[model samples]
Target: MSGDGIEILRLGARGDGVAADGLHVPGALPGERVRVGPAEERRGVRRAALDAVLAPSPDRVAPFCPYFGTCGGCAIQHLAPEPYAAWKRGLVVTALSRAGIDAPVAPLRDAHGAGRRRATFHVRRIDGRAEAGFMAARSHALVAIDHCPITEPPLHRAPEVARALARPLGGGGKPLDVQATATAGGLDVDVRGHGPADARARQALVALAGDLDLARLSLHGEVLVQRRPPVVPAGRAPLVPPPGGFLQATRLGEAMLADLVVAGVGEAKRVADLFSGAGAFSLRLAETRAVHAVEGDAGALAALDRAARATPGLRAVTHERRDLFRRPLLAPELDRFDAVVFDPPRAGAEAQAARLAEATVPVVVGVSCDAGTFARDAGLLLAGGYRLAEVVPLDQFRHSPHVELVGVFRREGRRRR
Candidate 1:
């Protein structure tokens, strides 16, 4: 394998530096001349190994994390903030261009300072010693870590918690997935990849939870010790989300997204929140307007319902547990709402978008983590005569390739085509 000096021209979709000859080299940056080894097929693409950066780019900065290149959690930590933000915003731009939809895309909002409120660590017994941390980059090999800077203070202590939990739970050589979520009360931890524990192990786990001062501890959704309910504030109420429930990575990111969605919906009296997880936007919007929250997860909907009922000063906030992927609300059903807000999974709400495209809703707001799927759905709405008002990118998951965006769509008249 010959090491050839290749000049990186741009960053690829996955944050890998790309050469003009189509060579993708990891850990390289644009305007940098890096010596790369022969390309090797990885995940269906031939990627060259970064040997050395012969000429460093002006935009390259020293990574803050010690495990920046080894840990798979972050991929673009070496990039400067300005270039990094531009590359992320360009992800949305490239996606929209590919979908053939032109809209006024806003500058990306930087909301990654609060750090991730949740982290899922891998735990295993190696050489008769318990170890816990994130997996290595693109591999199942576990990298034992003492700390992570990207996570919040509570979540950063997840590795220690995982180790403490594994001592009581793990006897076999199998790896365990420990999900730790930070709450105002304390850390809510969920351990997976192990069978039911015995009476002794359960007691040990209970003691460990007290030692760690965790708000709640669960084993594959089964509660071990619940000192207090892990509650998250939504609009006017505190919602006790289910174990391992989906939440925004950072508190500021959630607020940024919720504010954008609220602005998009305007003063619409009735709104439908589809794929609403734990009422992030639903609860907030319900403060000013009536919101019909629909989601696939029964637990999340239940939490939203309970929070909505207990909370005061909120308008009518109704909910339904329905899979928008398989069965989306039809045009007739959508007509009941003056505005609609949907935040689907990474796969996106394709079927729901089709229905919304056909519906004559005055205002529609779309929130997504996947740019490709968002653009596809936006194109469908554009083809159906909805005007793409704004697309704002949010750096929720910083130092990583993932980006969240909120798209505003409005249709004044009847559906076209």
Candidate 2:
């Protein structure tokens, strides 16, 4: 496969094309035959560069972003809509199949509307000017980008904002992590990787924030200056999230997940939202059901509590700041709620899922950004007598290899006494 060409059979889990002889070629799509260069083995798989495309797949399409082939920000942008959607949904299907959880998987939802609201840019000084953009695929080299179409219009201001704070934030000599989040008020910028800022640097950042008209700016988790609170809508209330807080990548994705969670819990009077981040699901569910929002982030919980209190006509929403991984709610404690919704991080909620598996809760909905972990946790629930009703995949991060899903599980028969 080195000197000769190889036929791309299918797209692998990492969005690379796999050949019949098991060679992985980046930038090659399925149903296409391509020539490959000498291979380098990484993680026990032979990876080769796509040298020439002798035949192109029908599903292949021109990428919208000029930086598509170089930037690691997106993969599969070259695919047509129909095949792209199929490949994305196939990720969840394969994961669940491997876990032996056979259930009805719904068609993938297009949650990539208007692009993502958050972007973490990589910034470094080159020559005398700051260069800000995404990293090249599987390399430390940075691809300087003038525009990013996959992000919201406000997030396109990241490069300018990064350049403004580069010098003041001590970013000349080292690379800086510039995380910009688009909020209702304005941009919320969080600068990391650079050393802590001093009083003088703090003053400079404050002035720069005003100049940029930024809503808030923080350095290494410390607020440098805040013109106004960065608010995100959660249900009927607006929540001023903590700097660098976890919110859905897109509002469209949040709405889809919330809708599924609400419908999964049905008309239950009481619901427990695990790993609730600023009440993305808790607050929405509270429109009808009394919600107990539990999370590990104290700041996020505080914001949720404030919103829950201020918002009128919502069912009581109580919050607890506890690490579910270290101390998950036990079966006896979980028995109080009729329905439970858990949206854990990429690692999934194994400890919590183990307990929820045995709990008497009639309904359990699992929301995950990782299909492998979701299937793993789903296996736990299935082994405990829970029936997996349905699994829905949502494409929140479009053109990227990552996939998000919501799984609904129900207890088959009588609850364990």
Candidate 3:
């Protein structure tokens, strides 16, 4: 609570209010319309209430999805497109500031709601019928819909095809993660496995692949068959991902990330790339830089090695399939590096981050898809005497709450503060 002129309610990073009197108000996450009392009523428990402005600061328009309030897929669709992009950029700067890092922030371009190559929709049997759509925003109940504009045409076909197959998903079926990519061969479907659709269900599954003209087929957790893309000079990096292997669903997004990672390393001669999956960043970086990639997936590494052998300039890339969670690279072994880059999963890197703080690397770049976890790991780097320099947020998942950001961190000068 401030002086007699104006009272401060809940202090926010952007000087906003979370709530005034514990009443539930909606609109915009990390946003609240705070109450400002007149000079006369400065004292007391600050128990005043005022109408909260939940709009996107005059920068956002109402969302298009009717199930926006109930669907878990999107969080910011309600925002005006321009303002939504601005808010995301601020999120990146704010995250970097939290890490005590201040560098040049870059403008995010092409922030649109298109080119979604991958999507996952829920499958449910409604009234003894297979219906496909997202769930209610806060509930697991299905909002059966045939088409999702955000998804690519082929991926959107998943729901209708599911209904045609009428596959029985045991226990009402669970969430299905369907990934797709546009390549020279055509659109490919990478269906991530889900619940068991019994023997009767298998018939329905096959019908889906055939009806949709899918270039690839996959069961729960398996890739049945994939239409191989034309092999350009894949460089010494393996691009043949195993059935469940993690491949960049979007080529454009992956290229941007890989470029940022390579630039972040500065003049790194020998660097360690952690959580290196199928050399997404590692192999790309290896085109010019030397890398010792660390990951837990042996199969993924095997594929990457196979790619490396085929690549001409891949002599610089090496990999070790180690469980960094159980055992991280020791400081002595890592002390020789000039820079480091890590693109960890949603969990972020807790143990690995701690070990990185003490490492002798100069520049460290961490790419994260999860904001909260990025903030957490950035905090660790800040404590380790690294200055958060730059953060670039990518709205790869449009109309959704998810944000992908890349932050470049630099080691502070060796002066004890």
Candidate 3 per-residue lDDT over residues 230-313, each given as its tens digit = 221233343666544565545566777777788888777777888987777877777777888889998778767777777775
Candidate 2, 1-417: lDDT as tens digits: 554578899999989999888889989999998998899997899999888999899888888898988899997788899988899999999999998879999999999888899988989777778889999988988888876889999988788888788878666567898899998999999998888767898898899999999999998877888899888888798887888888899989999888999999998899999999888899889889799999999988988998888789999899898999999999999999999999999999999999988888899999999999999999999988899999999999999989899999999875645
- Residue 66 Cα positional deviation in candidate 3, in Å, after optimal superposition: 5.1
With a 3 Å backbone cut-off (N, CA, C), the pairs that clash in candidate 2 are: none
What is the TM-score (0 to 1) of candidate 1?
A: 0.97
* lDDT against the true structure, each candidate: 0.89, 0.89, 0.63
All candidates: TM-score? 0.97, 0.97, 0.77
In model 3, the runs with Cα more than 4 Å from the true position are 1-19, 22-62, 96-105, 108-114, 164-208, 227-238, 247-249, 414-417
Error of 3 at 115 (Å): 2.4
- Prediction 1 global C-alpha lDDT: 0.89
Quote model 2's TM-score: 0.97
lDDT of 1 by residue, 1-417 (tens): 335577899999999999897888889999998987778787677788788999999998999999877888898999999999899999999999998888888888987866998889889888898888888877887888998998888787889889888887764266789999988789999988988889998999999999999999999888888998887777568987888889988888998999999999998999999999989899999899999999999989988988888898899999899989999999999989999999999999999999998899988999999999999999888887799998999999999889999999999567422
